[model samples]
Target: MTGVTLAKAVKKYGDVQVIHDVDLSIRDGEFCVFVGPSGCGKSTLLRMIAGLEETSSGQIHIGDRDVTGLDAADRGVAMVFQSYALYPHMTVEENMGFGLKMNGHPKAAIKAKVDEASRILKLDDYLKRKPKALSGGQRQRVAIGRAIVRGPEVFLFDEPLSNLDAELRVDMRVEIARLHKEIGATMIYVTHDQVEAMTLADKIVVLRAGRVEQVGSPMDLYADPDNRFVAGFIGSPSMNFLKGQVAGGVIVVPALENRRVRTSVVLPKEGATVLVGIRPQHLTVEAGDSSLILELRERLGGVSYDYLRSSTGEKIIVETRGDEALPEGTAVTLDFDDTKAYFFDGQSEQRLR
Candidate 1:
């Protein structure tokens, strides 16, 4: 069964159309993540799914039921926002069971559900405390506990860990992952953080300016992006695009000696301008058949970044795990794994071969 489906989804705010036509399907029990930069419409899309925003055109389905026109509460989905919207006056147990009480659930049933959610979220000890007494992570967990008590068919999280510090964020991320595993419920998470998307998603939906750029597993998007935008967006430090020309069935870029260094990117004709992309981790400061000229290395503790200048003046970054020092002004030769290089048409910014 599909947990959610959006067909030709679009959103328009006055004269500006935010979301273009987007089609997506998330499978049952899968943890899907929607990720993009600010104002890219990821959060807008999530809100549309939650019934907080009306879609200008398209259909939204949750577990075989069409929810395009439904109210937020009628959609049978639970949402955890970035801010833990707990009532300051209410205790943790009261906040967790508030929705159930408002819906006229029996007191005993509400208590049972709250207790179960508290146990799952490690909030059993804080059940009597107000929101002011809890830490950021604990308060966020209470927000999540509120969702858990509803036992919805689907879970929607909009940057739920964004309020915590880095260490707490990591801890909450693990908790969310574990919660998904234990509940076996379909979840959709929205975030701008690439690390969160890469680590948590079973499938990633990459968005740009309200349009869907690519949808795939984390590694699939990382290893084989459909275009320059996706190739550049998926990894940390980003992929390096070196300016080169496609000639003689090979990609030719200049070496430090001003000689043409060739690689295995096949071209249909000679002298066709193309862009070559390689991940920072894929390049090494070692001489090989496919060497690039590296300069201006930056060291930051355990990780070091090498600034590489191609023959055509395109600058690329090469990241290494160890803190090895290389001369700043001296030219170092870098070898890229041919198998990892991505070829794109220079004009269209689209993947070629």
Candidate 2:
């Protein structure tokens, strides 16, 4: 029930550094998520906080204690990894109580904690079952239950649901969210899945190449990203980018059949190339005698994403509702509110406000 703080935290191995100076603060009882693509140092940063990885410099404080040099077991943090590291021979109850048992806690006390955690995770019925006897979701719940029984001040999860199938992943997401709500413990979750981060995090830390890109609430990052990397990485289907050239205070997009888009944001110098970004939801398409072709249409129940490609091979995804299908070869024209378009510097890929 305490917050975690990182002050200019850095991690290194001999000569190469994997985690840069990362400054983050996870509020008390907050669900903070570290999210980015693979090898982005989200997991490395999480391990640094869990004391699994040594901090090369700076300080990590779990509440008021500087746990930078503490052993993993002494850090007061429990980490559930991408894999459910369960003992194949132990029953669910035994696995949940193993840590306390090893720590020399009384049998009665261990049982009480195990029972309470099992009740929270809805694993009371499967307590007698071994790992081999349980489904993927059950095994993951057992893993989480194991962490809960230890009663750590902070819980760290490194993609705990990645092993589950699509259906089970959704179910476990709900289960984990509910568990956090019930226990109200400070949790730090790491995942490459943006959907998981968007759905679960109270605050999200977006990382790339060992650097902290941006940190904010889900919608805050979505609606207002500091750079093109964050803007493209944080949303589903991702935001579409079209190249444009500044001319007479307007952007001319060749992908849109040389259409001109005017924006209120200050423009770059004349003839400077810029990136015009528009989310799929903001783009509307209509059948017309234009070079943009409807390459494919994916029907996903209530929503459909119409894939379009221009003469220059620039691809765009137009998200639409309903099950209607547009012919693959249909020529289309793209329409979007000029106000909704975001302009970014083509060179730096940074947002131009």
Candidate 3:
């Protein structure tokens, strides 16, 4: 149960560099997740920490040891990949114990470790089953069980639940969270799924194009993002952005029928362009002076979302918990507190405040 640290880590392939100087720290027994879009270098960074990819520059330390130059097997870290990669011919029990057996652990020790892992993963009933006979979730659990039997100091998961169906993904998410609590081991999970990152991570590292965008708890990143990219990426339904510019110490959004919205962030200059961001949940729809037309409505049991299009044609999503559904094609006003709004530089896409 130890932490991991990366100091100015860099990775390159011949002339091209994908992972920039990344400096990160994961606390002991913490569930840290690396999350971003495809080719964002999250997987590369995870591989670097697992010693699968060499660090072209900088250092990586697991616990107290500098493991930058260590081989995958010597780094005291176990990786569960996107694929289960199970041996087709072996039973669940055999697959789980294979790593330890290959390491020359005694038969008794291997069986004991495998049994413990199976118990943790709730795979005792399927121990005798081969890969082909088990469901997708079961196979994944077996893959995780294999990792657990090795008893590595840190566990690295690279999109381990991507292959599962929606229902199984949710089930496995709970299972993995439970596993973390039961084992209390430092874990680093990589995924492009923001929902998974938001639900599973104790801390999240948001990466973009070989760079660290932001790092914080899920809500922290959601409520307060450092840049436009992060503000838009971290939340479900995404934050709605309206084009605007500063005028008379307020931001003027043309999409809202030239309505002026006040912001606490200092304006760059009068008429300087900026982006106004508001979360869908923060928006309230009511009869008012604004000229927003409800274009569509999505009712999802306990909640509903109203999709609106402004006079300027900018689309907005408004989340509501009301039982009554708003009729589409109805003209309505969208209201939100100015303080709840986020301002970003139009050019840099950085948060103004």
Candidate 4:
């Protein structure tokens, strides 16, 4: 098995600790993504796995071997960096075969490997072209081909699509997905874009301040979050948080004009402050007695988002797929199912279950 495992991993710079003690296991041939905000140490952790960063104190196992102290070249991992670090003077074929040639591989073997990688990446047509002559997406594919030719047990991608334009990013995303399916190598990708993480990963490890917040499949984190942060961070447009309090065996949301809402879980003690979470997709705009003022509407072809402000100045986003457009400055009532609502303790910021 070419799985990767980290046991009590910790990274520190002098007295300040960056990567907290983390324990994780990535199965063989699984696509795992490390996702978080900048400075959360996702890239640092990826580099640690690739042997590019030193592990302060922990055991890092790649397959059956403990590779904690091994150099990058001995780790059997190929990293595709964000920047296309190609030799501008060399052709794509030469750049892809350079590593093997330096390692004293036979000319015939190197040629065969390069040819296979070029075919997989659809770079056969541009193999003779220099980096300066190819487009950004094509250059990135060449970089990936370089890694493919190495035939490492694991592949590390560090925001490889971030440098490309939006359209090119989408195109490269599909290409990478296809390549993963074709090669079936253990892949660990790092990205700040949740959409990329959601679309590409078989399992997602959400990090915050160098600590693991949650680790699960994308839909697991989306539908069954363990805490408030996971609930808010995993979804697009984020989850709306409204002020509420537990009173008389029910939760009452002040932002919704003290409407009594029911919960599937046991309520906290009376007068305890709590937060009511509703996803934008779950909320519907309808005529009612609620005091939500529509501030703006964003139309995106088949769907739309209505930005509303509550009486308490809390901003709320409501997603509607209907073709009818709601005008601005319209006072509308927001409706949502009670079962779809999430409750969190305001003091601890943890989900109230």
Q: What are the lDDT scores of the predictions, listed in order?
A: 0.87, 0.94, 0.93, 0.93
* Alpha-carbon deviation at 163 in model 2, angstroms: 0.9
Off by over 4 Å in 1: 254-269, 286-302, 309-313
Query: Best to worst by lDDT, what's the order?
Result: 2, 3, 4, 1
Better of 2 and 3 by lDDT: 2
163-253, model 1: which lDDT tens digit per residue?
8999999999899999988888999999999889999999999999999999999999998899999999899989988767765666776
Output the better candidate (1/4) by lDDT: 4
lDDT of 4: 0.93
lDDT for model 3 comes to 0.93
Name the weakest run of 10 consecutive residues (lDDT summed) in model 2. 320-329
Candidate 1 colliding pairs: none
State the number of backbone clashes in model 3.
Answer: 0
lDDT of 3 at 178: 99
Q: Model 1 — which ten-residue stretch has the worst lDDT?
A: 254-263
Model 1 accuracy (lDDT, Cα): 0.87
**Cα error of candidate 2 at position 43, Å:** 0.9
Once fitted onto the true fold, the runs of candidate 2 whose alpha carbons sit more than 4 angstroms away are none
lDDT of 4 at 310: 90
TM-score of each: 0.92, 0.98, 0.96, 0.98
TM-score-based ranking: 2, 4, 3, 1
Name the best candidate (by lDDT).
Answer: 2
Report the lDDT of model 1 for residue 336.
66
